[model samples]
Target chain A: MLALAWANLTHHKLRTTLSALAVGLGLALFLVSNGLATGSIGEVADRMESVQAELLVLPAQENMVFSGGAVFTPGWTDHLASVADEQGPLATDVIPAYWSQITMGGQQQRLFGIDPEQMPLFLGDRGMVAGHAFEQATAFSQRIRELRATADGQPLDTLLDDDEWSAGLELVIDDRLRRVGQDGHPYEIGDVVRVLGREFRIVGVVESGVAGRVFAPIETLRLINDGGRQRSTMFFIKLRPGLDHLVAARLFTEQLGSTVQVQPTSDYGRRLQQELGKVFMYVNVTNTLALIVCFLFILLTMYTFVLERTREIGILKSLGVTRRGLIGLSMLEALLISSAGAVIGIALSFVAQAIIAMRLPLLTVELPPQHLATAVAIGLVGGIGSALYPGWRAARLEPAVALGYE
Target chain B: MISVRNVQHNYRHNGVVESVLHGVNLAVAEGEFVVLMGPSGCGKTTLLNILGLMMSPTSADSVALAGTETLGLSDSARTRLRRETLGFVFQRFNLLPTMSVRSNVALPLRIRGQHADGAVDKMLDRVGLLPQAGKKPGRLSIGQQQRVALARALIGRPAVLFADEPTGNLDSASAGAVLSLLREFHRDWGQTILLITHNEHLVGAGDRVLTMRDGRLHD
Candidate 1:
């Protein structure tokens, strides 16, 4: 029986190969699409949790970690700092930051305005890979103050020389951004990157997966974006070593009223998934449809194959091969094809991952084991399931009638 | 051994009943070689099908094969009976073209959950096809393919061998060769043979000959 099934498949090589490839392509699409969705969300959550802060304070409506805009004031940070001084154990440090979408080197990306002096403390043990961490940011802030005092409120870019402007707004980018520079080249230290409509030289490259891809000094950004009103969109807070962040978050929420949202950084991944539940649902629905299409394709292919072998089936039946035996043979063929398709799908997923990594460096693509298992299961089960009707039809065929079939 | 008494069969198509076999009665003892001679559409194949347990007659008093009453047996039971007691050769030589000659001959043993145990090679040697065992049925000549089919049918050592115009598509020499093999198997193993044919010249090879016409049989 096994020999006969194998022979039948090999007898029509092109059809079998095409059928398997169709199934393989469907599984690969499901895997890679789901991988991208989960991978992008996971990447953002991981980077947010790596910011060295136990908690973040944002405007009440802002639950997503990467949403960038000037939504509140730096006065909130001063208030948090005041509380840290008073409570002693409830809080230790508060760092103000501004986040916004800005174009750099003709690509839109997230930019975080972090305090030059406190950025290192907030990033505890996360060292830079190239140059220094905002070494001239303090001096640049002082220069901005002096220029504001003397220039009668002239635009900052006009008041300074090109080199002075570059020095005043130094940029620090993550290593991922460095891989994709203007004109298909990689960025390096001392290269000027245009951000927020101003040229700022890249001073340092930090390890990826911490905060936004691009960063600048808070003082300069606040003065430019907030008109020196000392506004900040969020504040990162460090806690005493043994404190429960959930309790701290509840306390912050109680004190800040309905205008602020506080959450522990560690819970960001789960929270982000909840916040983007609809996106994930859409992805799952789309992938399931792809699986169904693959199932239907196998069904049609196997059905046609069985039809073509009517006379052969009749011969087997006449030779006393039971209906059960015939059905088993058909299902066995389906299993073999599906198993081959699953292997092809897995290989194709890796190829897809590599392509995505090369073309879009910042977009992480994860091939989790469970997704692979699910894809293979779908292929196998679907193949068997799709063969059921065709096999049954073949089994139910009358030997005399089938033998007479042209 | 085969027996039939008052067996009848009909096929209905588009509200019209076409009777193919009517009250057919026949008996062939164990080891007897019987030839059923008939014109086309004269119910010879239908009677063979009923005797082979491949079809259930619309009406029958008794239709027994190998001492078992087969008229009302379940499909699986009939299938087991067919596998255990009978073999068939068809006019088209109905060899599975996808399989090599040896594999085709080994099919019955495989279906019966028995290993070939050199039976396939032995049968191929008997059929003078040992050199062609590895070749697919499609690559063989018509006569060779029929010979392979004959080997497949006889390899299981069935009690009854049913040949439905086994040499219908063969040349005279090929037909003579297949008929000789059938005679040899019957003489050596005492295999009960029911061969159907329209060729009157082959009637001499059978121990008894029955003619069927218009769904009725005559001795």
Candidate 2:
């Protein structure tokens, strides 16, 4: 029976190949869609957790992953530090940070601004991959003072040359940015990237997922925001060892009142996942549709195949092949075809992943083992489910009538 | 061994009743070779079909194969009887084209859920097709294909063999070869045979001959 089923498929090479390809295409679509959904969300969550913070003091009513402009006054940094000290030493460190998006290499890149002195605590072991961290705080202060002295109550750009102003500022960028632009060239150390109408030299390249793609001194970001506005976006707090983040978050909420929302840093990933629930919903719908398309493809293919083999089926019945045996033969053919399709789908998924990586470097496509297993399962279920009716039809065929079928 | 009495068959097409067999009766003892002869559309094949358990007569007083009553049996039970007691060689060979000759010859036993245990190879060797067993049926000549079909039918050592114009599609020489092989099997194994043919010359090969015309039979 197995030999017969396999021989039938191989004898009709074009038809069998087309059926397998159709099923493979459907499975591939499902795998890529599912990969993108989980990949993007997982990347965001993992990046958030990589910051190594215990709690976050977000601007009131702001729960999104990305928001533009400064939302908290710079004075909140001092106030939060003072409050944490008074609240039974609730936190060991309180770091106010600013973030904004900037366009570079025709892509929107996240830029985080942190105090030069506090970066070591936030970065942990995922330190610079090239060059060095931001200069000592005193050196940055000295540069700011020199800029003020040269400005003499006028715009710094007007007072100094582009090279002179850019030479004094430094930017620590993510390693991924090293290979930017359509040319696929790397941005080496000392290379300048223009942002906010001022060029800043790249001082270091850091591993990705350390808060943002690019990091700069908070003073430099403050200078760029609305012509040196005195405001920050959020605060990252590290609690004292053995302190419960939830309890500390509650205490901070009370101290700051309703002006700020405090939450454990661990919740950031879960929050982002919830925020993108609609993406996951769309993936699920597409996955279902893909499998349905596969089912329909197999159903149509097997029906036509059975119709063409009516006389052969009669011959088997005449040879004493039971109805159940006929059904088994049909199902076995379906299984072989579906197994072929699954292999093709997995191969196509990897090709799709490569293309995505080449075309959209910023996007992450994760082909987890679970998703691969699901794709294979979809193929088997779709193939077998769709074969049921056709198998039954073949088994139910009257031997004499089928032998006479034209 | 086969027995039948008062067996009738009718077919309806497009709301019109077409009676194909009327009051047919047949009895062939074990090891007896019987030839059923009739012109096309004269119901020889229909009667053979009824005796082979491939069709149920519209009405039958009694029908038995190997002493087992066949009428009133379920379709599955009839299929089992066909598998265990009867073999058939159709005019067109009816070989599954996709399978190699060995696989085709091995089919009956496979359907019975029995391992060939070298029976397939031994049968092929007996039919002078052992060397061609690896080839697909389509690659064989008409005579070779007929021999393959014969090997398949006899593989299970069935009690009765039904040959419906088994040599119809073969040349005279190929037909002679097939007939010789059938005679050889009957002579050595005493295999009861019910062969249907329109050719008068082939009638001499059977122990007895029966003729059919207009839905009735005459011995």
Candidate 3:
């Protein structure tokens, strides 16, 4: 029976090839679309996880990590420490951070302003890829207390300020800046870049994968972003080692009052992935539509194949072939065609991935085993299902009338 | 043996009643060979269909096959009876053009849940086309194709054979060859053969002859 179905398919080379190609194309598109989406989300998730902070306490109402952040008193960091003393174990330490921007050689760069003293508690000083690690890697308050002695009887904030009462902000350049830079000149350690009339010196260069370009002290960013007002954009709290981070985050969220939103750093990556999924919701839509189209195309293709073999069907029936036998034959033919098409589609997915990578190197396309299996399974289910209508119609064909068909 | 009485068959075309067979009756004894001769549209093929169990009689007063009443048989039962008792060869050879000659010959038995084993080989060998068993029906000459069809029809060793204008599409040489094969089946195996044809020469190939005209049979 299978041999007969195969023979019939091979007998019409052009039609069979075309139908298989159509189904193959549908699967290929689905695979490529899904691969790109999955790969991109995985990358973003990995990056978000690298932050390593247990909780991020954001200002009430707005928490855009990039821009338009809600500005609140930098005094909130001071309040958190006292609260930790009272609430004990709610949060071991809170680091105030700010986002600032700068223009260098007509190109805009993002700056992440973090407390230099508190940064070492979460990330090691070795975050610096080149030049030198942060000189103040120890406890920030201890370093400030030591610097206060050399302040020559001045206050700590005034002493931390650089020449002309402006703090000399230390900047770490991201490697991405060098990659996008023009030839003959590149940013190196000690080179001073002017940000808003303030000459900020680059102390180290870090890999862009881990950190951003133009990192400055939180106080420096507050001074620059708010015209000397010491207001931090957000606070990142690191829970003490071995403590349940979820419990700590929940406790801190309640302490921050109703307006503030406290998000666990662990769940942030997943939330970002979910947001990205919503943005690419059309990929799912396309996948479903492609599956439906695949089914219908196979159905119509198999239906036509049966119609062409109407006289042959009649011949079989006259030979005592049963109705179930005819249906099985038709379904087997469709199964073979669809299976071939599925293989073609999977094979072509790699080609599609390669082409996408070549054309847009930043975009990733992956065809994992589970995803491939899902695609193939859908192709086959849809293939067999689509043939049912036509198979049934063929099965019910009366041998008498069909024999008499011209 | 086959027995059919008052077998009436009709079909609708564009919602109008168009009767093809009207009160036809037929009988052929065991090991007997019969030929039905008729003009085009004389309902000879229709009678062949009813007797072959390809179609049921619309108004059969009584119909029996090998002493069993077939008119009252369920569709599946009638189909089983057809598989167990009958075979067919058509004018166009009606070979499954896609299948090889061996597979084509073995199909009748295969549909009845029997393995080909050596049955296909025996039939092909009997038809003198065992050498071409693996070749498709299209690759053979018309006479060779007719012989393959004959082998397929007889592979199950059916109790009866119905050849409907088996030589209508064949040339003189091919037709003579097919008729000769029919004669051989009847003489050597005592096969009960009912063949339909308009050619008067085919009558000599059968032990009995009948004619169909205006949807009724005549002796």
Candidate with best lDDT? 1
Q: How close is candidate 2 at the interface, in terms of C-alpha RMSD after superposing the true interface residues?
A: 0.9
The numbered model that scores best in TM-score is 1
The sequence of per-residue lDDT tens digits that candidate 2 reaches over residues A224-324 is 66345447888888888888888888888888899898888888878886776786788778767766775676677667766777788889889998888
Off by over 4 Å in 2: A1-22, A66-70, A85-88, A105-107, A116-124, A127-164, A167-172, A177-180, A183-204, A298-310, A404-406, B3-29, B41-47, B55-63, B97-99, B213-219
Residue-level lDDT of model 3, residues B125-198, one tens digit each, is 87889999999888999889999999988888888998999998888988888888888887888878889999
TM-score of each: 0.88, 0.86, 0.78
**Candidate 3: where is the Cα deviation over 4 Å?**
A2-14, A31-43, A63-68, A76-235, A273-290, A361-370, A403-406
> What ranking of all candidate models by DockQ puts the best one first?
2, 1, 3
lDDT of 3 by residue, A35-146 (tens): 8877755554554455656777767676343456577674687766554424365566777767776675346655777766655543433365676434432233344546
| Model 3 DockQ, alpha carbons vs. true complex | 0.57
Candidate 1 off by > 4 Å: A1-13, A65-70, A84-92, A103-108, A116-138, A145-163, A174-195, A200-207, A254-258, B12-17, B58-61
Judged by DockQ cut-offs, the docking class of candidate 3 is medium
| Model 1 lDDT per residue over A1-406, tens place | 7777898888778877877887788889888887887898899888888878898888887757456453775467667755532446466888778876787545777788887877675456677989878878878777776776777766654676766655667888888888877788888999986676667889988887777788898766765677655677888888877778888888777777888888898888999888888888997787677767767766776677677778888888888989999889888888888888889989999999999988778878789999999999988888888777888887787788788888
Clashing pairs in 2: none
